[model samples]
Target: MSTSDMQDANLQEALVTYEKLQDIEDDMDEVEVEILRQQDKLCKDIYAKRAEVITKIPQFWPLVIEQAPPDVDEYIQPSDSALLLNSLVNLTVERFELPQGDPRSVSIKWEFKENEYFENKVLEKKFWWRRARDGWAGLVSEPVDIKWKEGKDLTGGMLGLVQKVWEEEKAGKEGETEAAKKLKQLMEDTGLGGVSFFAWFGFRGRKISAEEDKEAFQKEQEHRQARKAGKETEEDAMDEDDDDSDDDEYEMEIFPTADDLAVCISEDLWPGAIKYFTNAQEQDDMSDIDFESDDEMDEDEPEGDAPANKKRKA
Candidate 1:
């Protein structure tokens, strides 16, 4: 055969190979669904066993949060730390949509004792795995209201104020108001409006029309398969610069870092609590060390306690 004939043959072979790869990817996605289902069942049983153990341990959740990596620790303001230490008793994360809905979704519940900070006995935040209009998918959640006591708001009222502004803007149909702008300024201010980690409960991410989002997702997937099969079409030629992944306009405001914080809690701190707790204890042990020999490491160590001077942040 001529050189041109060989080139055409090779191109056809490549297209066939690409089509095979797309089929394998689609099969993998199906397998992932079953894997998530199994994981959901396993986690439910594990969480039940953990619930009994964690409640007996004093300050278990707080210690885990305290020892979180610096990225997460930065969100825990001093007041937030104190509130968790005093009031937070039990924290649990579960695939709440079991038996029917998507198991990828999770609910994080915080069981708190009666405290001056908030009135509620329980605060739970549910995050759903949702796709936006542009087909990008992640965790999207509704805002959770935190009923603050008269003078004990850990968010410095920023979250509450943001919520109020969001409602007002939504009702008025006004584009953006002076109050929203001022609130943004206050949030930036150093003293008056420091946001707390607990404000993460009030996070509201993208949730436009569900049908449109799903349609876009389906369209994107079809286009992806076409591209993999070496087919060029209008969808492939569509403007790459077009972006629709921003949080829906219905959300007047957002906790900018909420997604990162949410993942940290659900994925890292919740799942790896035992590791974080052990690390916290090891940290406490290191502070009291007087290592005379290598064998001293395994010997009965002193009872590690929280720092005596760890006073409430005023």
Candidate 2:
């Protein structure tokens, strides 16, 4: 081969290798970006899970501990403790306890047999607690072997279970405290145990009675009716007063005879009465009192104008 051809071949090979390297670098950059995004998403999910578990642990622990069977009959004498302890031991297997430092880190295992349907189940829950400053914390947990049986009266069934646990704990077989026994008994006796644990823990609000709503509605209606009746009575009284005034006006009379209707020749009312009488007589064609004629232009037309006097031949 010629020297120039060999040189050209080497340059071409170098250019192709450089382009391949750039492509590989771009691919690596994309992969790294995607990996970072995935990591961020995973961390967020973990934090969320932890937060939920932490929030639930404190609330769940108290109820579970409270409802557990009692270990000793602290109320009864020392001799009776053995009897109660024996009864508890015969029915239940193990006792669950809240961890000392962080509640979220607690683990619980409960094993029980369902004699009604002849089934055995073991429930286990694992938790992890992450602490923060100012007493804040997060938790992550998983539950295993929790079952949803068919045809179960959910409320009644759960209450029954808690009641049974309470009984066992009361006998001291389930390793529950004396306080727990008391709480369990109280809840069961008050019919609160039949409620879902979440509801009992204040997750839900209590319902109001229909009677209360009806009573409130009736009160509002009565108030409205009373106001309406008062308005109607006021209107009726006003109408009655108006009718009385009309009757008084109808009974009043105005009578003016010709003598009483005579016009006095006083300056104050003379002009008005003269103008009125003149207009009236003119309109009625009564020209006997011919004040317009010079013959009747006397200084006084008597006190009031009357019928013309008849004069005999002079």
Candidate 3:
């Protein structure tokens, strides 16, 4: 072929290859956008669901305590240690997006208040979470942060209790020991006896009777099963009086289903959860700045509205 004809054929082939590459890039961009949308939606859904669960604190808190890992019991203060779990007045949560990195991590803040102690004082806790490695998306807390009132001098007892638990944990891998139980009873006899101390550990303690809570939880499960079978529950048929006895102040379950709890805080279900998500807009801005810094520009190239760094030939 003539040199001019060969040059034209080469140009045509290059154009076709470039078009194919552009199509692949466009497809990738679309997929990335979809992923971002799904991530944002998941963040919002997790937040709303967590908030809903928080609202049921009064009813479901007991269930949460019951489900706690046994290790938690070791840290409980002798019920008389001025740590009043029943004094809890309310629970609140805050969720926020990170200013940078791995858009999926969310920071959550939990605030707990006590009506009877250190008037106007609040306990604040913070944790971070994101998707899981092996299961449905769920949050796992980092190290916990707790803030107590200043000048109250009340935290020492709780801190000491935690320290002792940690020491015991470090010294032995066995479950609750007779020595531990004796120490607890001695503390109680010496005026440390009290009710369940889960609240002091930042978990809302059981407010309802366990037996009643269990029965109610079971009823809810049965009700759901009946619905799935397209049948009305016996309680639904004889409803008015029995239902009337159930005050609005009651909650049957902390979580309606295992899946919701799992997605919110993993299968182990921490007392609370936090999750993270990257802010796409911030990420893009940072990328743009990085691209500009790394780009190789010629003196003749205008800086106005340029695309990202163009790859240079070796």
Candidate 4:
């Protein structure tokens, strides 16, 4: 065959291959769209069912409270003063599929009405089935991470306590190791440690000023009065200085957990904080629960080439 004719034939074959690839991509796109629609319908149905069940039951809060992890029980303060009773804005069970071939996971998230301080969020116990050949066997829940609203920023006090604890741990003080472990766990769970912390604050650290502390206390008093009067003011209405974004010198990134909040206010600060941290950690040990997900199982697995195949790191 002539060289020109051979070249033309090769070009025609390449065009055909390109067209086929385009057709496959189009078909895959259509399938993905259909899958999304089905997922949307399923989610809506699940939400509706959940709402109906809760609405029908007058003792819904009690059931939910009972289901809460033991560690959170103290923080929940199930008595009349408990925020869960009045501020529980939402409770949802949402299913999230892992990368294509992996099994899906359903997580229960509870969001309380945001108060003056940090936003209150709770990730309820995560449950999953073990990989087995026969009938379902391994059914358990992981320790839930709960973030409580403090009505004001106490990050400075918490950070101070953290530094004090670190110094004690360095000095080989009694019970410091156990306290350190609990602190580490809390930090890892809440993304308040190491690189995550650096990412939020960069090289600079935030410390609430004396004046700001006084202001915070004043706001708390006002907040309490507003709550009592049943007329909570919008956060923006409280003060123009409330914007943390404009403060170029120090940016408060991580907020204190409920446990940390208690310790910060305690007279013995660091010692009390360590005790609170250790107690919460001990609860998980006695409970015999594993919170780590399946994706977090094999650390030595070869990394996947595609985003869908990649395992998320803790």
Best by TM-score: 1
Scored by CA lDDT, what does every candidate get? 0.72, 0.34, 0.40, 0.41
Query: Model 2, residue 205: displacement in angstroms?
Result: 20
Sort by TM-score, best first. 1, 3, 4, 2
Cα lDDT of model 1 by residue, 1-314, tens digit: 99999999999899778767866887797698677778767787787888788878979988888788776888878888888878888887877777776666788888899998889999988888776545466777767778999988776676776677657756875655676776667656633344677778767666555576568767867877676666764433433443432523323443666777777777678878899999988877765453333236435445684323322212
Off by over 4 Å in 4: 52-110, 114-116, 119-314
For candidate 3, the per-residue lDDT at 247 reads: 33
* Model 3: per-residue Cα lDDT at residue 69: 41
In model 4, the Cα lDDT at residue 33 comes to: 46
Root-mean-square deviation per candidate: 7.2, 48.9, 26.7, 24.8
Please identify model 2 stretches exceeding 4 Å from their true place. Answer: 1-104, 117-120, 132-135, 143-145, 153-194, 197-314
Candidate with the larger lDDT of 3 and 4: 4
Candidate number that wins on lDDT, 1 or 4: 1
User: For candidate 2, lDDT tens digit of each residue in 1-314?
Assistant: 89999999999788656655655665685586465444434555563554465454333322222222222111223322232222211111111222223222333333343422213354433334332221222333221222334543223343334334435534768455554455445545655422432111111011112344345445534544544444321111235554564343222111111111111211112223224434544544434434345355554467678745643222
Which of the two candidates, 1 or 2, achieves a greater lDDT against the reference?
1
How does model 2 score by TM-score? Answer: 0.19
Model 1 ranges with Cα > 4 A deviation: 1-34, 169-172, 177-181, 188-194, 220-233, 236-254, 290-314
Name the 10 consecutive residues with the lowest summed lDDT in model 4.
195-204
